[model samples]
Target: MSGQAVLGVEKARFLYGANRVFDSVSLQLDAARTALVGENGAGKSTLLKCLLGELELDEGQIIKSRGLKIGYVPQDVPPGLGDKTVREVLESALPHTDGGEDWKVDVLLDEIGVSYETAQQTFGSLSGGWQRLMLIAAAAKLAQPDLLILDEPTNHLDLSNINTLEGWLADDDRLPMLIVSHDREFLERTTTRTIFLRSDGAHSFGVPFSRAREQLLHRDAADAVRRQLEGKEIERLEKVAARYRVWGVKNDAFHKRAKATEKRIDRIETERTESYVARERRLELHDGEIDAKVALRVQGHTVTIPDGSRKLFTIDRLNVAAGDRIAILGVNGAGKSMLLNALARAYDPDQEHYDGQAAVRFNPQARLVYFDQKMAELPLRTSLLDYLVAVDGATTKDANALLAKAGFPYHRIKGPIADLS
Candidate 1:
């Protein structure tokens, strides 16, 4: 796993509009399997796009060894249509056509639990899970490319398919793979290195995801301590300045020394002050009594498709009591989202039919407050105090306290979020 094809960047810079995503960022990726982990808008995808040569860096160069073939499975796959079947999709990854080697396709499909009859079926007709499985098999069937890149590859896959992919990824003979996945278990099983992209930029760690997380937390703690020490030094300098001012009124010798001391204090103040970094916030459920009384009740709910000929889904009955912290779990297009929308409507009946749910105070998943790794939604143009006032309706004092709780320095409350990022 050592001294393999080096994929790296030097002084990399990326910009989107006026926003600078990465400034002087750099990292190295070697032969070991690596996992890219970050929150929604943390530029993980952007980094991958750079690696795939889909997007060029604004101010740096990415160098890969010569003749490196990269196989990429994007986050979104093209609609499974046209003339391609499951077998054909897998075969297309190969350099030359081997139409006669039907057994190879059969073995792969069977290993992934897809029957030969199923392979003959049109890709368009299959469910999302099956299509995802087919794509995984296709990627695996490719002759060892120099690097394999899979972005959110587990999205629509089932447990079995994920396990199969995991086993393939864990193989020693397989080429180095860069996987962007939120599945902690998958990262633990396959990746030997973890690269975390933050608002600051990309950082590579030698350890796996779990260990990398621990290392990051420890680093933040140390940083906090360093900032605190700097703050104390500032306070001590301020005290010396005050003492000098008092002495300057009484003695001529003291007055000259006080002026020099005041100048030194001013210089100290001008030095860049260390600001505390905010850590990730975790949700804490309130400990309160929940009555058995149902907060929401849905019965015989069904959504008609746009064509008016097909029913997307039908749920016979569902109930949710007050204080129930429930997660609606299902694959994409599985009607879990539709069911939530329907429930919101049922709870709020004052609005029009078009306004699905108006009565219940349902926070849409997209609208729920999230402090992602990139802090994209943060008010970059305004100060931290202003941003807090805008988002949480907090006054200056309350906002400062909140920032402190989130590990921000007192002086940084007036600093612009853009500067922090």
Candidate 2:
């Protein structure tokens, strides 16, 4: 954070089509591990692209030092890579029309703490955690660039993979990095500085993420107190001036003094200290009113997934009341997954529909939304506004209002759903 900056952005501005993303933004980046953090649709990705030279500034300048090599870790791998092995995946990272060297693969695999023997497995066959680690390692090893950029690296990683990434980031000081992540602990452990993108502008803090947030909150609270005290003083001065004005009708000298008091009140009001208030973007969720007395009920509810070997689950009785919160817990190979599938099918235990061997009942008006442990299949090409309009319970105007409630601004709703943060 102390050395001369290798990159400088001066009065930077960028626009997506006609919507202005950044206005007169300015910042400096030296050889430091910096974290880029902000709410969704706050232009963090756009700024990163500008830094990487992938996007051009609309009305400002970016000064970069000579021969500034940048390595970018991709947010996602291409779908066709599922059939490739780990070694093949790493080798493909090179510009190979005919052939490429294999030693680079071993070196990067070792650097990322993966054994060479493990490279024989198909890249897609590994757990999501290991896939992300290997993908990052491959991208990093393609070229030992001076600056490495990672965006949301923890997206598919598990706890163990996340710990591995933490070690990799903290492994050296020589590597300058710009990391964009929602993982607060990862930013705290890796980044030396943080840049926050807000509606007002991009603000840089020479401290860890959590510490910077704490400072912002504390400063805002103090400003609130000062504003409250100043409010009372302003009110008192106005009342005194009003009383003097009433007396001025009877005496001439009182009128002159009343003018002075009015001037004093105007000075205080005009020259008052401006307050600094921090804004937060959040979505509030509420469980609306459920009129049904009995939302769902089950009697002798049992489930089993058979591989022609053993029974997976057998429940004696299960009951759910109105507004009941339920959680299913089990280890690998347990029937937790099967239970959910059974609910979706509305199946009974004895290979029959509802009321076969087990009695299952549900209110006809009840609706459910399920989030499986897989990426949602969204219409990536469709605009967010269009997608929301397609969904039930809201008109186009109502959809936009709901998006506002969820902290998304009006201009961004017309963009593609996949482009949304």
Candidate 3:
């Protein structure tokens, strides 16, 4: 990887009203693929938007190489492209190029081992993972960008798709990239540089994610120690100055000494080491115990496609007890989704009221909470505080407290959820 800085931000500062997202953030991306990492709502997305020219910075500038062309793959598949064939979607990226460039789509699919049938299929007809992969292929191969930016590319992917993405990235080593992801293993395998975005600024390291994170945390610890020592020194100085003041009431020399001591204390205060105080944020799960030992049971259930024209798989018997962890594994296009979807569909809150036997049965005392991978249930326009307040038994004060604990600034609580990174 080249050491030359290809893209960078210098002293960048951005804010939402009085809420500061990041201040004095600066970093450079060279030929080495870089990972942009931070806590949720840490302004990583906002910073990327600033770099992509979608959002303007309040201070500083984004520097790029002359004629730099960037290809960006967002977290979600772009709207209105679901009706377009995979080949057509790739061709759309080359609108300004000559007609001869259409051949790149075929070459890209072949390079990634995609079949002709997949190329002819509509973008929306494919799984979420495939849809995202197609967009990436189009941006990288068809657009011919100088740099590629991928945001959470593995959000809805299965293990097979994730491996495919990793392989593609490994093969495309010539292209510089700025990837924003939370997948530690993916970053460790794909990126050579790591950048940590914080409320005060950004920290950059040449090492991969794990090593870079270790170095950053170490530096924070050292700063904390230094601050503690500085505090003790200041305390000692203050005490000496106080004693000198008491003696100076009777002597001019002591009065001069007291003034010098006070000056020393002021200098230490001015140059004292400052450590970062992280926001009170936590990621936790509801720890409620089920009243029944056996939470669910399944027997003779045949999982099928949405239209029920074809059967994917069948379960002779399956049991899930309370406090049990389960994992369903399969390749892409297999019956993993079919099985999960079938189970989710069978779960009804009123199942306890019905006495009829069924293929799937749940204990009456067991409660179910399903998390959709697509995050379709999240309301885009509602503010974080308002969303929490809407929850049963959650008061406005409680919501605000929870938001604070989740590292959201008080000023940003009223901002729409869509604005979150």
Candidates' lDDT values, in order? 0.68, 0.73, 0.83
Candidate 2, number of clashes: 0
For model 3, give the 10-residue run with minimal summed lDDT.
348-357
| Candidate 1, residue 344: how far the Cα is off, in Å | 11
- For residues 252-371, write the lDDT of model 3, one tens digit per residue: 999999999999989988998879877777756663577778888999899876778778788999989888888877766566766777777788877645434688887777777665
> For residues 242-311, what per-residue lDDT tens digits would candidate 1 score against the true structure?
7867887987777787778767767766773444354554434453443445555555667543344657
| Error in Å for residue 156 of model 1 | 2.7
Model 3 TM-score relative to the real fold: 0.90
Residue runs of model 2 more than 4 Å from their true location after superposition: 1-5, 78-80, 93-101, 107-118, 125-127, 219-366, 371-376
Best-performing candidate as measured by lDDT: 3
How many steric clashes does model 3 contain? 0
Clashes of each: 1, 0, 0
For TM-score, the strongest prediction is: 3
Ranking of all predicted structures according to TM-score, beginning with the best and ending with the worst: 3, 2, 1
Off by over 4 Å in 1: 1-3, 79-83, 98-103, 241-276, 279-421
